[model samples]
Every structure is written in C-alpha cells, then in structure tokens.
Target: MAALHELPSQMRAVYLREYNKPYELVTVDVPNIRENELLVEVHAAGFCHSDLQVIHGQFGTKLPIIPSHEPAGVIVQIGSKCSGPWKVGDRVGVLNFKNACAKCVGCSLSQKRYRNLDPRFCDNRETAGFQHDGAFAQYLAADPATTVLLPSSLSFEQAAPLMCAGATVWGALEKATSGLEPGATVAIVGIGGLGHLGVQFAKALGFTTIALDSRQAGRDLATEVPGGLGPDLVLDSTASDAAEKVLAFTKGEGVAAAVVCTDSIVANTWTLRLLRVGGVMVPLGLPPDRWQFDADVLVFRELVIRGSYVSSAESTRRMMEAVGRSGVRSHITTVELDDVPGIVDMYQEKNFRGRLVVKMRD
Candidate 1:
C-alpha cells in the first residue's frame, strides 16, 4: 500500500459527462486497484484522435467517462494479489488493450500472438480510452500485464504517446516490412501521428522510406534533418499523377510495402496502387467509411492487404527500448491537464502538429 501522504483521495479530471457534449472539469475519487493491478499516479497523458471520436459518440461510449489512453506515470500502489514484476515507484505507461483474456480459442490459434483478433475478443478485453475509464486524470488503475516500463532516458511527455500511437505504427511497420529486405522501399501514407512514426521506424530499420501526404507540412517533416526526420522520398497524394509518380519513381515497379496510416478511403485505395507486385499493404487508420480497392489489381498483382491495431505488450516494450537507444521520439506539444477541453477543440479543427501530451503534475 502507498502511504496516505503520497496520494490524495480526490484528484482533478476531465470527464465526458455525456455523449456529443463538451468535457467537464471535475474532481473524482482516485480509482481503486484490483488484484493484479497497479495504481498509477499519472504524470502525463496523451490526447488521441480516438478520444475525439469517442466524444462524438462514434464509439457509442458510455457517459461520464475519463478519456485519454496514452498515459505515463509512476506506480504508487500495488494490489495485494498482484504477482507481476510491478512495484511502487516504478515508471510505467498503459497499453492500448488492457485485461485481455488469455484462455480464448483465438489465443490458442495465434498462440497469444493475435488475441486482439479473437472472435471472443472484447468480451473480456478492456480498452483504455474506449471501453474503460481512461487516463485523463491524476490517477489511473492499470493492469500490470498491459503496462510497459519506460526507459530512464525517456521523459513522461515523450513516453506517453509511445504507448498508443508509437505502438500502433510499430505493429503496422512490422507487418508491412515482414520478410522484406532492409533496402526495400517502404511508403508511409498519411504522415500524421501514426504515419510519422512509421517513417521513423522504417528509416531506423534500414529501409528506404517514402512518405505520402497531401499537406506541405507532411512533405516538409518527411525530409531528412538538417531538414527533419524525413523519408528518402515524398509523394504528394494531391497531384493528379500521384500514383503514377510513385510508380515512376520506383521505375514502374512500385514500392515493396505501403503502410496506409490515413482513414481516408482515397488514401487507403491508393495503397494498392503504390505497392509492387506481391507487396504488402498495411492499413492502420480507422476512417469512418469503408475502404474500396480494385479487385482486379489485387488479384493480378497478388497484393496483400492487412489491418493492424495496437501492438502486443512485448512489441511496445521493444519499441520503447529502441526509441531510448536510437534517440527516436515523438514530436509533441505539451499542455496542462486543464487544457484538455480546448485540446479537443484543436484536434477537431486539425490545428495542432504531432501529438499533444497533457502534463498532469503541473
């Protein structure tokens, strides 16, 4: 148990009191820890577009919930029955999926590799920022099994977004680049939170990275520093011959892999055209509409289309370790916990750059 002095009974939080309504600042009691759980004192939380979708009732969310999934913090209290490696004062961040059942048939099929795809999935799974009360507060109750330790070199602000955005792209990139050579061409479409990270990871893995985006900022960020953390090439998806440009650049062969990070149907459709024969297309973004592709192209080219969600805990840890060692980090804008409501407004308006992390301690 944590000393009473170390924690308060009530903490400040932003609550989604109703669907399609603005968040309200309120004081709520700190969440109780269950067996196999840790009580984390949140240092920082990351605002995700998924949270915005929930606020709009896109996920049919339950009311009066605390939102924000990307949370990094220190463990203050451990449940009596907790048996994992967790301890008080340990730095940790929450994973996208929490409380997954390890006994499902899907778990048996993938041998625990793709439990998130189990038919019985979500029956026992609790998702942070979606199906459960999340980290938009000073404290969060986390499953030790779903929490990742942060490296000493990573700050709370930098580690928060890695829990979700970084992990999602890492998983997608891993799938996209599987069985491909290091020098193979990889295209990251969208150049947003997930897309940007995909570019970084692809570049780090020694692949020639190509970034696809319609925005000048995306093209700019995809340039190598002194310029930025950029790709080897950038394709402007807005151009009439954008697909043709990618094909021409690849000598009419297309890239080895195209990771679609945007939910835009157009962007998703473009992934098929941007890949070489037998190349994999990984779509990680959730657009509000169904993605349409040419069946003839898919059949003739023998292309692969796969959807990747949040990564496994093991993958997340590996990504964090790599980020710490390689100096890979997310571009973030920090805000106070009280600034969450306005942050949501900015997200809806698409006015921010990179990720927005909320500092709860200040």
Candidate 2:
C-alpha cells in the first residue's frame, strides 16, 4: 500500500533464532498492521528478565521471535478498523497482552483480580515476548486496544518499563495494599526492578514502607537509586530471623500487607510468614518450580496469598497516569538494539543493576 511504502521497506531487528544462543540482528520487513492494529515506530524497549527467560528456553516461547514487551513508541500508521482515541504521531506503550476478547468470562466478570486468570482470556491470550513477536525491533504492529497513551512528561526510556514492570507491580500493590490506610505498614520483598518500583508506589500511596532484600547490594539499591528513596525500615532477607525482625518492626503484629517480587521460593515464603493475621500477600514473580506453600500458617492466621499475573490493560493505563502524577520512575541504563545480545549475557550473569532499556532509535 502507498501508506506502507512511506515507511522503510526493511528495518533492523533482533531474532531469538535458537535457545540459549545469542540473538541475531537482521533486517526484516516492516510489519503490516491488521485493520485493528497500529504500526508503531519503536523508540525504546525495556529489557525485562522475562526476555532472558525466553532466551534460555526456560519459558519455551516460540523460537526465532523478537523479545522485549515493554516498548514505548510513536504511532506511524493507523489501521482502518482501529478505533478509540489513538491516532498517528501519538505516543503509546504496549502491554503484555496483545488482545483480550470482550466476550470472555474474565471480561464479563470485570473483576480486576481475575484479569489474567480467566481461562477464556488466558487460553487464547497472546503475550508479547512470551507468545507473540515483541518489540526488539524498529517497528511493531500492536493492537490499539492493548496499547495505552503515554504521558507527555514521560520519555520513551522511562515509559517503556511501565508496559510490564510498572504495570505488574502496580496491579500487585493495588491488591496487596487495598484498604490500607495511610501510615500502614507494607513490605516489598525484593529490591530489584519490581521491588524498587513497589517501594515507590507504596511510598507514593502514603504507606510506611519497608524494603527487604537478600543481599546488601540490593538493599543499597533500594536506598540509593532514584525513585527508590529508602523505606522506613530495611531488613536483611538472608538473616536467620528475618521474619521475626519484620514482626518486631510492626509491633509484633507483622505488616498489614506485603508484595513479594522475587522468584526465590524462600523469599516468597519468608514474606508470607511476615504477614499479620488476615494480612494480604501478593506474589508477582514467576518462580522456577512449583512451591508447596505453608498450609498451617494459611489456615491458622487466615492470611490471604493472592497470585498476580502480568496486568490488565486498565491497570496499565492507570499506572501511567499514577507514574506521571507521582513522579515515580525507574533507573534505566540505555543501550542500543545492537547491544541486546550483550545485555542478555549481563542478565544471565546477573551483572547489571536497576533495569536495561534498549534505545531502538535515536
């Protein structure tokens, strides 16, 4: 089409190719958009640990796919069937879900907690970076329904992680800290990307937050990084009496709620133990293996352990607005798309800190 011809015939992109192998950079045709899709010129894509999993064959994603779901870009073309308030030249961010059928049970129920749990949605869902070709490229076609408008004050680099990191933690925090009055105690059990953002959100929401990490380095990150103003209390997760310390910090009643963002089973369990009776624990991380949770504490204390999946489209929109209003942002180290392979290696060795975002175009 003449509209498509106005754009480049081919664009640079990275391909997964083989499992546990270096991603290959190659030129590929600009994606053609469906009637309900928007062709976005990606400016930046956030490098998430989930992308690392796709590289390591851990997630078993369809191979030879482009990975990196947290992308922010400008719309270059709009499809005929695409509706809503979006238009060309609009800045937008793509969420984890490519599309969700409105007729699904999840949509009908309209329960935010079950946003990603409904089989009707989950069974047919296409997850960017996990199920669909993601944003590790120059251009991508995204469903307008799943994309949200970016705040004018936010740069692409900052807005990119909101697509996943920000949205996921926001959903978890809303669930974990619901009905928590100001000055209420809340714990974030992981000072990495997700935990760090959780701290910012908790603080912004007026909670007396505690930062927890297994290592000194992560604790320092929680305190030093921008948007990671050290919480009221910092706890050593590896300490033998870590849970006891949390209990003591909250006047022996334990935290009103905690959001566990670590994939470590022990960390998840520790946070669960750190909750007060009837307290809420929202687990957002994907652990490597199935864990046998403590049923004794569950039944005795009547504690609630809720599982949080990626996030609903509505959560993503609200997160962007909150981030813009609250001035909460991630500490991102920008790299070019060409450095994606090296970034993957850095992730594998756990060498990088904060979050990495690829500047797809200058």
Q: TM-score, each model?
A: 0.92, 0.92
Each candidate's lDDT (Cα)?
A: 0.81, 0.82
Worst 10 residues of 1 by lDDT: 113-122
For model 1, how does the per-residue alpha-carbon lDDT over 1-362 read when each residue is reduced to its tens digit? 55224678899998998887778889989887877678899999998888888888898877778898999999999887775777688998888566657666555665555644432244567777887889889999887767889999889998999888998999888888889986899999888777778888888777888898998877765663222346888878888988887777788989999888788888788678778999999988776677788998899999999877777777788888777767677878898876777887776564456888999996
Q: Which regions of candidate 2 fall more than 4 Å away from where they truly are?
A: 1-5, 101-122, 227-229
Candidate 1 Cα deviation (angstroms), residue 270: 1.8
